[model samples]
Target chain A: MAEESAARKDDDIRILAFLCNWCSYAGADLAGVSRLQYPAKVLDVRVMCTGTISPYFVIKAFQEGMDGVLIAGCHIGDCHYLKGNYMTAKRFQVLRETLKFLGLEEGRLRLEWVSAAEGEKYAEVIRSFTEEIEKLGPSPLRKKKAEVGA
Target chain B: MSDLKSLIKEKLNDGADAFLCLKEEEGTLLPALITDADSPDLELAAVGEARYPLGKILIDLLREYPDKRFAVLVRGCDERALIELSKLEQVDLDRLVMVGVACTEEEARACGCPRPYPSEVALGEKVEAAPGRETIAEVESLSDAERLRWWKEEFSRCIKCYGCRNICPMCFCKDCALENPHLVEPGVIPPEFPSFHVIRALDMAGRCIDCGLCEEACPADIPLRSLYRRMQEIMEEKLGYRAGESAEEKSPLSFLGSEQDIKKLERE
Candidate 1:
């Protein structure tokens, strides 16, 4: 039991964040250049457009033990690819609701809009999201039934 | 009744391959492929006795003999199944002729079906039957805890026969997550209850045409249709998409939607 608790303490939360390359990714890079510090728990994947992010990817992340997922894109009409963010908005709406119906907490997934100029907003979003998830603790799905002998 | 017999005879008289319909043999009605148009056995087109997984059987035969064009008897459920199968590229819709038969009021009531008749009818009158969604209503009326408990109880009886998956016209996949050992452990009887069933429900989001075949095929008598019907409602409400409505409308989950699409689900 002591060994299990020690291992649990060492276990860091795994967050999967999908950032649109044109805006949110640039904002993330700017935060680094500005010497702004944030938690390293997040692993970022930059995509050409947030529209390309499938709900299947999000579901796969959860199934694989991702404690939280963040989707950051350009504000509505401000999409670099014109109407690309439209699809992202529609997909996540259904995805979030569907996840709730499946008995998952809606807070586990978060979506935000950050512009290239808003490095501070990007940092703030990440900080708040990470804190929110930390309070929620590790995803219940992460613990295996066999590990707890359930 | 005789009019249906003559309709089948006239349709078959053109010398197409075979006419597939239910035949009453020794008080049991089952699907039979009749080739001889002149045979008196064609008189047994029982309306409500049995419903074979005609779409699946048709797909199998069509695959075996690629060059043949066959005529099939379709009720509302069968038409939906055929439409779904066509989308999956399992059945060639162009090469087949659909002989639509409208279901009786009692039949429609028993199945709790809304559209108890196909879109285009070659036989039977288009009568208005009250859509019965009792299964969904029953589940929807429960509290969250009760709903969860109800589903847990219902799903606990799953034998993993794959009957629900096999009979589903929309479930035409080369690989399935339900069969994956990593996602669903092989030896588990109820197959991890909510996970297995929920995964399937999620997959059926925009694809299931509400054929009710999955529920019919379950040996355990799980109310699989209710779960899928709820999903169908959700898909329609969220995306304004309904399966089997048109071949051109792609499933929202399968495509990259617009920013307008995203706004519909976001908080104001």
Candidate 2:
């Protein structure tokens, strides 16, 4: 079984998630505490707010070989800073359109709103997003295996 | 061309502190700031074919001479840049007078400019709009993999020269993102694929005036203008906003708007 799991690791893909500390991060923690089973392919960075997530971060994540990127924050009108998520919505629209224009698959990037209480929702988001990314295989912009290892 | 010289002289005598225009020197046109009406350099003030980021220079000049009023020779793109810069608080529109010169038909066709004349024409006749959509359509027609390959091949030729940024008139940020080590790694030749170019394209989204100077300045012949023009089109399609086209309203992306605005965007 250990050998089989090790073999599976070679085909594993990486995803970078930017979660807001106010809502999405707490929601992710709830998922962990509730023992929810979600895909382990996602590695998350907790930001103070989703507004702090620059479009550059998304671009850099793709350029650095991540198969997918996810941005989650408070629901509209529920931001800790009152209006941070509004900027996120606006920036995400532009960034998504930009990535699409650049020929990247639309499924590679996503944005969601997960409240701190929605642990099940958080887990389900990860599972569905992971499944979608798996179907797309590796990113076209991913660095070669040798380059990543180096 | 002599008409521009007299207009400059007239403005200089009419309480305007100085005039900023191009003058032929050693058979090449260069920017000249004439302070005296009787200066011999006034005779050399000719609206040459070559274009410079005169608005960028005007920003510095206005800041340096805070109390002086200046007249500037402007083409369509220059006027648009100054209008946008004024919105950004980089230029004092009240302190500067614009002398608009319409581009010739041949010049307008060469630039692929949509609007080649300013609001008020001081010289030359207005030409028909020649929009450049061929490149944008070409990229759109290609498959995703083929499109990526095309851009990568074009970008790989980049020598990391920042000519595109330096020549941009609307670019006025003191601390440039292009130089940031975190965004663009230092000492990397060809600058990391899609990072450098896409960063620039994103930054130019609602800011670029589509002047075509960056493409002109590019030594590697990267289609910088086409990239930026598409960005402008995206802004127009998504937000119904175009840079340098308005005098009252700011770019929606530049502000923290109301909940109603968010709702409208979400529905779309």
Candidate 3:
């Protein structure tokens, strides 16, 4: 029983990450190849472009028990599809503010740019983001078993 | 003998196929779509506290009767709603006329609406609406933890009634994120905080005209207008776009941008 509760506490600190396929996904792959150790709490979803990551997906992540979310895209002017990252930039700005207004911690949602060659930076970001969410604890939206059954 | 009736009658005589206005019948104020100028409907045309999704209603009338031109009694917020609708091709502006009505001082204060008069005031004198920031101030006055606690408490009261979305003039989507089971989970009273309201706020970012109807419709009194108002401010600050301002200016979110736009946004 004690072991099960310890495992449950570890499971509570989940993060959902959306990585743009062209750059951030490659960077993450490079991090794995280089044996750069990062927290396993982040679960990644790869999309053609960061612009494709709608605010609904972010909201849904929190609703489904994600403690934090990270969106990584190509640097501006580096998008595989020209100008796709620009849309990502604008949407991310608005999404962060909207989430902030609703009382979500500012550190819970993050956006970063990682080139394919920047494997170390990708690992570093994941490490730091995991620590931040750890300090914040489980998401407020995280449903309890009693509440769900009720 | 209100100025609104004479204006409605004039429009009817001058080739308007129909006029849409509020009518007080047996102590109930309802939306009255009038065609005949002699039908005595103009006598009951009223301006009052009752707010309706008039722009949403006009979309049906205009599409159903494509050939007929109509006039609508519009308030400041209603005008903005209609203007945004026209941009989306939801309503044809060429076949419609606006008989604008300015809100009374008391009514404006009660609604906490800024700019209480339409561009062309066909009736009533324009009065200044009392500026409202009490809700924003109350939330801002708290620490992050307290603010979160306050929002959690406030959101717990939500019955998950879609009154805010239903009455909004700008919400014309056939597939709404708020209704999506994938986005907002089904069978939950007081929907998971920041999901339901956050989705609506994100959707309203570059679209909400700030009609204040959402706050009025919310049985929870969740200070929805303030949330959307902050969205509008962030939209302007980040993307330099304001919804319902111009028919020609597309929302910045509607399309991709150049490096210059992104650089300026970053600097801000």
Candidate 4:
């Protein structure tokens, strides 16, 4: 079991997480403050709004060798900008479908809504997401460009 | 094609300052912007078996000669491009008249045109062009793993040639997102899998008019039209919208959205 655990440690998976500043980002912060034990595999980038996360940003993450991507935004009717998350919903839907059509696994991209109060939920999400990426192995893009340059 | 010539003459008499269409010069078809009635260029005004970016040329003409009214030859896809261009404020549709030309059945089949003829076809017999989704079907049939491997191999052949964007009539932005180094890494060959192509496909969601020009221009022979058609399907399915279907209806992406859209998007 020690050797098996060591083998699991060798599995390299990089997950890029984009959290909205208003809700999801604060929730992640709350998780950190609460000492919620979750895997540290996620690289968090906070945006003012998920609506501003152009499909190209997600594409660039995948291209740069991210094994998976997580987009967590404000809940419906809870956008700090009133309707920013509405646009996020539409764009994300289209982007996800386009990615799927282009042959990326639908599981590789995920969208969720996390409130600032839901630190436990955010931790739970990251734990599950990290496990999922582990099962999927390293990204094909990562394998090709092993250095995964900036 | 004689009727086409007579129609051109009629339009010239009907107040159009210039007629822009394909003119054969020594058996080579090229776009000719004919302004003089007796210039003999009109003699070569034949709709030869070639497609040019007539919409792009029209945009230039409209910009240069703002006061002049011009008539242009438009295939079905060209018509859609102009309609979408007008919506984008790239072209003033009011000052231009469209001369519709229908693609022959053979050309239509080869090009996979859904509507092979323009709305008001003035040339050729209207042939029913069956839109083939063979590539879409094949790709859809693949398992998720197979699909990923297939696309990785296909996109690996890209030489980063901007022919797809250069020839696309709708891509008239002063600063194209594709060229933005931040969006698409400048020096990377194959431009990092999925990003280069995904950026384009997202932009094309409610905008691509199924011209097949991008595929024709593609050196790597990427099945761009099929990919775009799938984008169109998602747009229609999710928002009940298709690009260039009507003149006044705006793309859902353009607006913030109605309350219904927000609710629907939230649920989805």
Candidate 5:
């Protein structure tokens, strides 16, 4: 059992994507219907708006051993709830700077704009972000199997 | 000292309902509320080295007695906290009068305070601002892994006493985020590393007044002042906002400003 977990740890890079319901979620859906190929390791959570994504969720993702987190939503003026993404942009800066200051690699977390029509763009963001996270390797915050028992 | 007593007396007689200041009691200084001008406690009012969250106390007092007016003694840090708290709608500045007291050189040096005197000093000489970035610079100098390890080691000693939150003057939230079981798990000793401290750091980014009270209250000696001080620096660098700097300006995070504000920040 331990050996199986060890192999999984080496081969799997866990990625959690937070997609806003209005835009990014639709974008991901479009990517699926369009049969666009992306990393299978990526998992997603759908929220009503990007503004609802708290900094705590991002921190919790990393704490729970997520190797990478991507927050994709509508572009600045294109937000369904107008000005919702503005808060996301502002909050992203503070959260990114904070994580960077805490010695977390900058590439592990990312923010992007994916409109409902931008299926290709959503796939591309996932592709590139996965590559970046893979390069940075698993998060240092991830606890080993031995330590998990202790 | 005599001038401060007379000033308190004058304020009490001239419309102030009561005066709040520290009083010497058996060699220990305690916060005392002087309501009457002839109260014997008025004579014991002394600007001692001991510090407390007087701003937090005032918030409760002012809320309890809506119509009453107060004149409270303030150091530079205390004044800044009150100003920030007033902006957050926790304290009504119009109803209170400030009696500023500057810290001595020794006190300033011990605290590593950048601003040791309030805008108006009614007592003590205004000493030079102390350079308080040694810990920050030291941590910044280390590698990312080393820094993370250092913080983990420091935070592991936490007993989750919440003294830092309790003693903080700026903390007035009725529903505290720290107490939320979703954020901080219950029955965990020392709380989870980075989560407990990082949560606080994020919250304090644009609101901390750098009073060093959290560090003073911390039993673990976690260098919390430096952590929060770094948060303040990030606020200044990213958002061009510092808590307690100006009465007219508010923190950018406090409001949902126009799109131009975000553009301006991005362009920078």
Candidate 6:
């Protein structure tokens, strides 16, 4: 039983990452051109700004059984739209605090600053985040076959 | 006091079909609909210790008879409820005549109500009630761990009777998050800790009118009002919006207003 459970844990982790169109998405595109090797576990959604991400989206991601959520945005004061990152910063601060208050493991969600010029930084951030989430195991929110009455 | 009584009598005599207010029945105060203009039961309009949710009762009565027009005595909280109900399309505000009553100093103090009276005054003396900031102060003083523990303890006693939701004048939704088994597991006493209460607080962001009826109806004596009141403060601070303050202003979450609101989210 232990060996079987260990084998199950080896499967790829499902991660949902929100990339800002001006910074994170561009950095990810650059990483692909640079051929920087990283795990392909991430599913990315590109939004006009990281500030566009609602806390509801994060909650919904978990509810949908994503193992982790990554929110990558422009560096503070370096936003393409001038101060967009400021709103993202404040919202994530409150959302992270609120999620922690609800007894959810705060490590499952991460916020990082990735500039359009920093393709290597984006790749490194993704690699580290994926490793951390893989070590943390699958999200408790995932529905088990028996739990679903299947 | 008799002057106020005569004023109510005069209003009733002036073709007011019925007045909605509280009447002491068997030593317990309940909302009563008095139809006869000359009925001596107008004596029941006297301000007393017991409080009834006039808005809730009006919804039931208005639903039962759609064509009838009724006049109701409105306090600050009652007026707020009426405003929200009008927004929810539960009540026809134009059809109802409002006879506003100001709260007494003692009553104001008990409620810590900022606007203890309605828009137009028909009775009682207007006195400014100092808004009590103590509840917020107490919660803010606690560390994150302490705050979490405090809320968990308070929420642990929730009977899941949904008296709070049922009694809320603003809660008119046919589907409720608290009732949803996916978000909140059903048949669980105290309701899986924070999910039930947190969902309620989130939902109350732009709707709660600070009526205090939820806390009043709670069988476990939970401080549900303080939680919702804090959420109201957060909405006003973050979005500059207050529920029931104006019919023209839409809720912050209901619609994405302008580029500023969307931009503000990005800046954070």
User: What lDDT tens digits, residue by residue, belong to model 2 across residues A1-150?
Assistant: 557434745557889999999999999999999999999999999999999999999999999878899999999999999999999998888888888778888899999999999999999999999999999888989877675553
Docking class of 6: incorrect
> Compared with the true structure, what per-residue lDDT tens digits does model 5 show for residues A7-54?
674548989999999999999999999999998878899999999998
Residue range B1-268, candidate 6, lDDT tens digits:
3354666566567766677887766677777677875566766655566556788888878888777778887898889889877877788887788888888889988877879999988888888888777766787677655676777788888889999998888877789877777777788786765567766777787788997889889999988888888777766766667888876676665653455564565565
Query: Model 6, stretches more than 4 Å misplaced?
Result: A1-150, B1-16, B38-43
- Looking only at chain A, give the TM-score of model 6 against the true structure: 0.88
DockQ (model 5, Cα): 0.63
Ranking by DockQ: 2, 3, 5, 4, 1, 6
lDDT of 4 at B153: 81
Each model's fraction of native contacts:
0.26, 0.62, 0.70, 0.68, 0.42, 0.00
Docking quality (DockQ) for each candidate = 0.31, 0.70, 0.67, 0.61, 0.63, 0.13
Question: How does residue A126 of candidate 6 score in lDDT?
Answer: 86
Off by over 4 Å in 3: A1-12, A148-150
On a 0 to 1 DockQ scale, where is model 4?
A: 0.61
Superposed model 5: Cα runs more than 4 Å off: A1-11
Q: Write model 3 residue lDDT over A1-150, tens digit each, in one string.
A: 557444666346888989999999999999999999999888899999998888888888887778999999898999999888898889989988767766778999999999899999999999999999999998877777676563
RMSD list, candidates in order: 4.2, 2.7, 2.6, 3.7, 2.1, 6.1
Off by over 4 Å in 1: A1-6, A10-14, A18-30, A40-57, A63-67, A73-88, A113-119, A134-150, B1-3, B26-28, B38-48, B63-67, B122-127, B131-150, B254-268
| Winning candidate number (lDDT) | 2
Worst 10 residues of 1 chain A by lDDT: A2-11
Scored by DockQ, the top model is 2
lDDT of 1 by residue, B1-268 (tens): 3366776777687655777778887788887787777776687765545566688788888898888778888998788878777877889987788888887777777776768899988767766667557777776676545665677678889888999898787776779988877667789787764457777887888888887878888999998887788788888888888887786677787666665566655644
lDDT of 2 at A13: 85
User: Candidate 5 A-chain TM?
Assistant: 0.93
